[model samples]
Target: MRHRRITAALGAAALALGMVGAALAPAQAGGGHDDGPATSYTNPVTADFADTYADPAIIRGKDGWWYLYATSDPLVEGGEFGLMHVARSRDMVDWEYRGTILDEGSAPSWATDTSFFWAPDIRYVDGQYVLYFTVTDTELNAGDDSAIGAATAPTPEGPWTPVAEPVVPPRPDGGGFFWTFDPSMLADDDGSRYLYYGSYYGGLWVTELDPSGLRAVGEATQVAINDKFEGAYVLKRDGYYYLMASSANCCAGPSTGYSVFAGRSESPRGPFVDHEGVSLLDTRPGGTQVLVQNGNRWIGAGHHTVVSDLSGQDWIYYHAIDREEPWLSEPGGINRRPTLLDRLDWVDGWPVTRAGAGPSEGSQTGPVAGSLLGLTVEDPAEGRALRGSYRPDVDEQSGDHALVRGRVWTDEAAPEEVHVELDLRTRRTEPFLVRVGRGSNRIEVEVNPGERELHVEYGHGRFQEETTVPIPEEYDLSVWTALQVHVVEGQVHARLSESRLGDVIAEVGLELRPGILRSAPVELRGTGAHVDNLSVNAAHEPVAEMVAEPVRGEVLVEESFDDAELDGWEWVREDPAARVEDGALVWPLTGADLVGAGGSGGLLLREAPAGDWMVETKLTLDLGDTEVRNYQQAGLIVHADDDTFLRLGHVAIWNTRQVEFGKEVNQDGFLSWGGHTSGPPADTTWLRIHHTTNDAGEHLYRSAFSTDGESWRWGATWTLPAGSDARVGLYTGGGAQPETEAVFDHVRFYDAG
Candidate 1:
């Protein structure tokens, strides 16, 4: 259908069937320029520079800012992807990357250089900034047809213009055409508009538009069902009208479970249903979830876009996938898709996202949208920028401060892009600095909350350039957290939260060779801490400056069990109480679950050391929480027989607790299955896979994960069938109740160079 690209910063009196309409248009979203008071985020939400801000599409710019838009691929990683992305913010949680809206000398002179472009949507109607998108391929005829363009921008960071054709063309079919992919648009409070579009083979329609919303005037209709769904997104509320879309199989790495559902209908087009009434074109349809994947570290949470704020609430901004990194550099490539933001709520009338706990990972209460870009509230004891020991109070009545034995700079010498935010609490584990540029081209940063580390440095002292890292042991530091720091362009990222809305834990980056910094004196150093809100502004100019490389291979098979020897391994149902303590391998979980007829679970296979390899392990599995333990598993496999295989576990299913990554075949005769979802297992999770082959010969087996295996994240990719001899297993069992054990700790194996 519409694989998925997500984002949304909307509003404009939009509402439906239940009434409500017109009333948004006030949000500045981190685009209002963080003078901070509300806005406590968490969740990918474009983690400072697109790692993959897929199918998003925000829009909140009556000049206050917000604008987002994404889909063309890279803003990072090996680079070069397409020119469709755009970024801006002042509230959508502080973004800024902007470069891209059509290139190759401004594309769309009739599209068809293979035509690219994708998802998009944005809207602002009559006053300008329209957008819409999804061309895919065009040149008027031949195969890949796909259409629906349109553009026009006055500001949302666009030089835009587009629209000379395709407002919904190509329909064809058999000889190839159907996927006119995700578009969206809506409007109506009598002002009409409409648009929508299609996928999964000619399904989700809509039509109407015209008051210069760039064409598309007339019949169309349809609504949902063609092959389940595509990325639709409708909106309306109370009187109904909902719709939403996105279904399964989104870029399967680590077994993506692409979700989002919903149905409603008081009429934006026709009969939608769900909430039990079923029919989204029924065949087996039902819908009604509204962003899935709550097994944590986000999974393929569908393409979306909602927006409301200004105290009205709503929010949404979709695009997930980090079930262990999930793609962007080999392992079946390009899929990262960060950009997330939740809080949608609603309840009896539908709309869910956060209320149902779907994407959000921590730190909540945010989204007032925009209102603060005013600045200057200083106090630091009448500003001279403190120096050796410091003092000030505020915290509950204003900005805040308290450093104890050192620097605080920043009263005038700025520029280098800045964007700091310290909120402190620590008392002393030593290190503390923060400097940013100037003098000898700075970049310091000691930090050290009792060994959680973070020792940076950069061009001074003895020609510095240090490194370090770690910092996310739940970074306590006496409690009130929220670090942040973001020197743009030449890099120097930093994160570590707990309060600026919490749940970031750790983040780090560095760069700057000759690209050095220009305006320095931003300092902050400490020896006691408790600063609580030191802000430091001046940011918003990001066209590119991302990081994430991830390759690491080497070792070949380390094992590490410490005692009980199992030689080269080869069991299947062994379990004689399984032992080997000290270094791990415990094993217990048993309720025997091998899926279809091929049942019983114990496994342990071996023999598999060909080329491009990698294995990794570290299970744990306590499986207790909430209710029904219907699943209760363990992980790692890649066999070829037991009905063909591929596992990855950290299961529990019924009351949510995932890290799935399944794939059982045996198709023509029956078994076939599904799975995908990585990252977020913890209590000792750490899985890994990586076994390349590509170039079309297919072998591939990628999927990575970690909670503290020193920052990992990779995900997706799951092929096989290239000579197929596979082998490589490790198991435990589905649930049987109580006694759930499964320890493991190390199984290593690598050389995936």
Candidate 2:
């Protein structure tokens, strides 16, 4: 005869790393555990490299040292100085950040002092290291002549000598070959060297270079061209040449669309094939493989150059938009893309990703549950019991007995009804009733009336239903939670227990409360009972708390190019649509531009933008639709203006498409930042903002999903950034919403904390 309890069930659901937990298996045969290299999620430097730098280049020199070169600052929007930087990694995981390898100070006379560096293709040719790169016009107004150039050095890092003039054809009249950039030099297995260049509408082209690796020997042939692409990196594996390039609009803070796409050709140059054999120049899929994403050790990783480690394993060197400095989606901010590196696991001749499949969950922050609640197993195979103190209501009208015990009933128990004999023998003269209740958050089930009969109640919120059970045989009450009770109010209140309402129904039982006649020995009993992971109703009521707002403040901005006065405030990069003069920031256009098929732009300012702050930025938007997808309005942000900041932008998604007809989207149109929650057509809108904190110590933030930015309603609220006192800044980006561009006029802040 097996005595079992009906209420010993545990909730089977557990969440791990934002994913659902799988069912557990009975003890496994432990012989196959690998004892080599103990590794866990805590292991640092496991998978840390990512993204491409502007115009990447690499070479394994004769001296057994591997050198990599990249063009500097293609992504920097208006910085004064620029130079070539280098990094070296022997194992590929540990890298030494070597400073600037080359600069305008070392540039040849043929190249202007203000020429910006593009891509640098380096190789060990003959007895010297030949470095080939492109130099662009400086004035932002000087169109193109920013063509490719070259230099030579005896070693990887050197006191170098510049080769005279541009190595490739000079920029043509109109847009000069879309500005020659992304140069790659490949030494074929057959002892021949070739240089690849040309981007934008000009496509991919390859020209033969002499063994010296400095000058082009023959005319360059058009290789491939289609989707205005750049950052071309060519590699030869298994007798096939693979051309990898960066595709799509790759800027803007939290809102960026950047990825690497590839095409393969049997020859060094020809019709390259994508997955569908569609000419890569015409129909390459919008980047099939994602090297990295947000919440990883690396983010905004693209524009890469792949190199071989000393062990022959391929390592990709690229730049990642540092989590500290996110890409601004809005206009009023600087455009900056940093360099980062990572290894690409290749199988079946294609690059593979261990991104989501790695041992530890990617770098996203989550709720903190310090330790496992002190839970114990009452029955090894089926039941687990959680122990805690329970205070109940008792009366003094009857004998010296006032207590109640709760128990659960579940399918895991062998008997139809669990035998619960309470330890009432300790007080033979005292009479008590036990009660039980069910449910997790709120208990609805309860039982009463000891040896004579038992009563059970089931209900929650407002609706409740109950039942009763009768007992005949008399056995000494065992000192256990399985069957215990105390008499208090004559009505007999049931002990509470709880279960998750979304799934199974949970049940509980408790003894009724009988009055106490006199003071007696107080010994707690019925403590080890198997109860479902349900909630137990309490005899006493609880108190609730109110919600509050987060605190905000001001400080100087870091990671910026500011060298002005420190008057307790910071100046932001100039907005492309505005002129900065006097003490005030002014804009030529009244509204932000909605970048359509081509794209849009804008910027935002930041005094000290991080930590948690309720930001209210005023934007003047024009309600018009862009003919492209995902394009919307200029956005506002808090947290440093880096790629990691949060965005508060608008949408013209609800705007009519007719507004973009007959003309291109490069004009001035004004649309107020109204609360428009719908898709597009976000014209004529007002703005409202809100941020708050909860009792759980978490910050909640949200915006108004309204038409008028003023008369706004609440939108979605998410957790705040995870760090100590950070900064805040403005943001603006291009999207596929309805508008071409959105503008910002003014912004204000408040201390919510």
Candidate 3:
């Protein structure tokens, strides 16, 4: 997500070279299957390319290479280094990381070196590649200071030349309500061009562009409106114009409420309506929810672009935050936003994804046109499964004898053990065996016929162990060599022999654990691998028991803060200023800001549960002799996204301390309901927030406060738009006084049902 950071001191040239070297590092061996050429693909088409790339725009150049551009970083609080970054791919599946295309030194003279370059849309116009991008001031705040600019290059990869001036300059103070950013160009069939830009501040606006696409010509027109909208992309299909835009905050770590919504209009610029006939201008409910965050592994899936593959299948490209590997920054932490790809399907008259689901996780089929070999399997229990994108190839002679080449992804948490039995024959020495997992946490068994050796390697993270033994001469490599493998509880046991269920030539055991391995796919790799009957057995089990149960008329959590450990609560960001001390959750003020829109510095604790719930905590603000600032707050919060939340806290209004309640709906910015008392009962107060389903079936959040832990006075109630699950927690930050401290004596959660 978008979080401020301290810029790195590396020069542009040095940074470019380092990125090149990291991308060119040799890939791991025997990743999954080894077939002829790969034909299938999966998400993260570019694995481990880079950590932080967002607003992906990809295009196939005339040079037969695919080029991808995105918002690059030094992502400093007040420094902009590399603007637009580029990566190229020959097969569109494996991308080569090229460095930044535009740096601070090469940017337009009018643009400050600290301006944030975001969301560039490129298209070939009039035989030249035209690039339109958004630029914001050093703070990267969306306001009148944001502008849209253009550049041109003869080739997709180029030393681009920026236009003498910005194509769409920043508006004068209070000139317009909308923020002029996230520019997208559409080339109409009637020989007209248009540029679409805007954010939730005003609405989506479109204006006619000159044929060169270098400047705007006609008057701007409003086509769509939504208080939670950004990232406008248009696609013309049949006789309708599809306007796809992202709603809510796209970069709030795991708490992000980002999703792609769609509306259609007959004209390129006209009134747009969702499938439910709801106008885009309606604020009560948003546009049709097309794609949302699915699965716990990947969250915040939005800011997307749709493209057609060589085989005519539509694929959606976007960025998602990996929950396990969040990006840390100076002020806050951003969930690792990596580029991901998924097939887009057209069902009825609307766009649909796989199984009508959202972002994909684990293993999936690759694109249709790649050279990678694909394997498909069907079982009475597992149904139909297809795996693609195997990098190696088996010998031609081995392919003739090969009966089954299986590639399967295994969930480490499964209760049942996995067993595989196959056969291998070789005319020459080669590494042939089965592989489980990837990277540092991997397990493999290799049998080299020519070397007459058998080896087993297994590891967790960087620590690993390998055991090898000379192969018995009785094991014939010219004929079928039976192999059987059993994996359970992070351990693998393998036995190899000349015949099925015959005398074993070698037996090896390797220790591995599922916790370290995560969810890793298994691959049978090597040449001369011949097997008639390949058996894979894994008994099915229900997943509900493995996950936290939903809150249903039961006490979900109750922490007294007496124990110095945060067992059930997780920190949203790892800040040194926050800790458990003296039987309370103590968050000391660091003079950091985490109060305004998209602010940071607060210490937050999150717990995920479904259904109606209430979270209450006892907050005590201790500033000693120092005073609190207007933005400083300590309270209980029901945070849905950066802009959608309900906070009931002890806040300072114009330096006057008060117990205030506020709500930010649909990312339109925060609004206080003005139900504050003179102060927070001298320092200690009970803060309570409730999230429940109203009679109208809409999700509503309510806050209440009390001087003591018993009696309460209800504050304000706000309705939530339709979206994913939210997190409830206690927060303290944004205080002007660096010595201030907000202590939570106890926190409790109860099912409101």
Estimate the TM-score of every prediction.
0.32, 0.42, 0.48
- Candidates in descending lDDT order: 1, 3, 2
Candidate 3, which ten residues in sequence have the lowest lDDT sum? 19-28
Tens digits of per-residue lDDT, candidate 2, 1-753, equal 100000021111100001000001100111011111111222122123212244445554332234556555422333333467555543333444555566666876666665666667675454456777776652223454556778787766776788775667464646444557767776553446677886655666788876556777877777665333566777654335667776433443333334465666778775666543545544212222324342333333466666532111234555444433453222233334545444344433444233212111233211110111121111111223222233222212111222324332322211111112121222222223332232311222222224333344423345554444443222122211122122112222221110000001112233222231112111222332212112111111101111222234442222221222423434344455553334323334333342333222344444543434456545556534323433344445444322223445553222121011000111122111211121121444334345554455544445443344543333323233444233444444444333234444445565444
On lDDT, the candidate that comes out on top is 1
**lDDT of each candidate versus the true structure:** 0.64, 0.39, 0.57
Per-residue error (Å), model 1, residue 744 = 22
Off by over 4 Å in 2: 1-58, 68-70, 73-80, 103-105, 138-142, 173-177, 283-287, 290-297, 327-336, 355-753
Better candidate by lDDT, 1 or 3: 1
| Candidate rank order under TM-score | 3, 2, 1
Per-residue lDDT of 45 in model 2: 25
Q: lDDT value for candidate 3?
A: 0.57
